[model samples]
Target: MSVVLAGGGSAGHVTPLLALADCLRRRDPATRITVLGTAEGLEARLVPARGYELVQLPKVPMPRRPGPDLLRIGGRLREAVRAAGAALDAAEADVVVGFGGYVCPPAYLAARRRGTPIVIHEANPLPGLANRLGARLTPYVATTFPHTPLPHAVQTGVPLRHEISDLARADDAERLARRLLAREHFGLDLDRTTVLVTGGSLGAQRLNDTFGEAAPDLRAAGAQVLHVSGTGKQVEVRQSAGGAGDDVPPYVVVPYVDAMEQAYAAADLVVCRAGANTVCELATVGLPAAYVPLPVGNGEQRLNAEPVVAAGGGLLVDDADCTAGWVREVLVPLLQDAAALRAMGEAAARFVVPDADERLADLVEAAVEGRRVPS
Candidate 1:
């Protein structure tokens, strides 16, 4: 069967799209996959890198306010829908799968116009405008979070990469071995408790500054820090008056980590933003986390972390409250308490659906075959 997948603009959208495409190919080697995205979006590079045909679409963002830009959107959207429909025809798509992003609205419209089956997977708890609109056009809608308000939304969880998903099944000995290797790879001390601080791929300035300031205190509390400071963003470690001693734990910083599974393995606890993918991956891997939701963007990040925190899997703090003092008071003691960390990690693992990739692929197959998807 041939399929066209639409999503892009950011890693959040592109990552899951690629994951689903990979799952579909693995399930049926004969399947042909085409991706629809803007030429400027991450998908331009990532989709091709994954060896899928990417059909570039003009990005026609739906303007929020009434303005001249809003007036132009209708014409732009018409052109985009025409291009999208042409691409769909060229690919002979039996089904079109959409993850929420700027490219989705046109794709969904084109698929509907052609009477091709459409499946949508929304990765955020708070549905975006594109997916929200797409959900009305199709009965097959899957969601990463359980409570996303979409019609016929199935709680299939997020489609994660195999490398991240496989961590859920690691035996104790294997886990330890992987952890040791990961620590060695990162140049972190194996004996010390490790706290990983990340702000996703682009990095967060607030995270870098706050965590960088607290690094000395964290080391003094007998914990090593592995900080992924984002690409081109440098984190300056602030030492105390006496400066760091040989006995103090190591503080390592890197611009980016291409191999994130290794970083996840090496970390005893993680502190990062509450993006849907990050939350799901951490839960799938049974890693305890302190999630600081991004202060912007319609409050979806906080909503994403709520279920995990409510389920005893993780801790949540607002962006403004995630100060160095808060870290010293909360994170330091939590790191020192190994038993608490174990309990939280177990809770996290229990909350995840590790086989979400397969589940989502099943939905796509059901759509293609015109079979009823079992709820």
Candidate 2:
């Protein structure tokens, strides 16, 4: 049997697809998993590395702003759907699952025309524009959040790295993570609080710029900061730190963190955005974070962060209020109060669903096996 895994344009979307692929392979090794994505997406490298056949399409995002550019995006959407239909014909896929991103438009619409069972995993608390538009094309809707707005929602939580999953299951998530990879790889101080600052793989400009000004204070607190600066911002971020320490200052900055499992494990606190999949992973790992939802359309990141914050597992800082002083103000006391930090960590642990991968695999299995079974 063949399964089509569709989602990308960013690392956040690809991570879950990788997770589900791992689960599906174990359940049914004979399964041939094909990844359908755009040529310009991050999937170009990610999919092939995972040993899956990649079906590339042509598409671009519906830009955040309004104007005539919307017309171009609409044209691409139509062309992408047609491209996906062609791929489906070539692959003879039995089922197609969309993990959400710009890739959803083609995967969902094409699969619908082929009468292939369609499944969508909405990985944001507030659905993205692509996901909200794609939901109507599929009856099988799965969610990373427990109470997302999608219809017929099955709470699947988030699929994590294979190593992270194994570590989390061994009852020594922190220790296993430490041994499996060294924080020193990123030049982080093992004795000090290691706060990871990242805005997904492409990097968040606002996050990088904001964290830049706070580096001095963070270093003075005896904290080590590992900032993942996407693209050309590495020099600026490093310069922003102002030589906060000696021995490379243990203030590391990288363009992209290829080994993300170590990053999460080494982090005592996280300063980042809250995308649906990442939030689930953070909760699973029981790490407290100060989240600044990207101040973009619909405040989607805030929506994603709400449940965890409400549960006392994390803090939410609006973008307008997120500044260097604000970062130190929230984190300084939290880091100083070890007991409160531990409590918040424990709160985060409460949100994890241990059997999420298996459960999601079962749902996919049922769809591929057939819908109308004898009672």
Name the candidate that leads on lDDT.
1
lDDT of 2 by residue, 1-375 (tens): 788988988877898888898889988899888898878888888888888889888866755445687576777788888988888888899989888777777788889888998877787776766676667776667777777887677777777767667545546764655733657677666677778888877778878877777777776677777888886665254343445336433667888877776788778888788877678778877889888887877777788888889999999988778887887887877877878888988898787877677767777877787663111
TM-score for all models, in order of appearance: 0.95, 0.89
Going through the candidates in order, what is the number of backbone clashes in each? 0, 0
Measured on C-alpha atoms, candidate 2 has an lDDT of: 0.77
Candidate 2 residue runs with Cα over 4 Å from true position: 60-75, 172-181, 235-249, 372-375
User: Cα RMSDs of all predictions?
Assistant: 1.8, 3.3
Deviation of model 2 at 203, angstroms: 1.5
Scanning candidate 2 in windows of ten residues, the lowest lDDT window is: 235-244
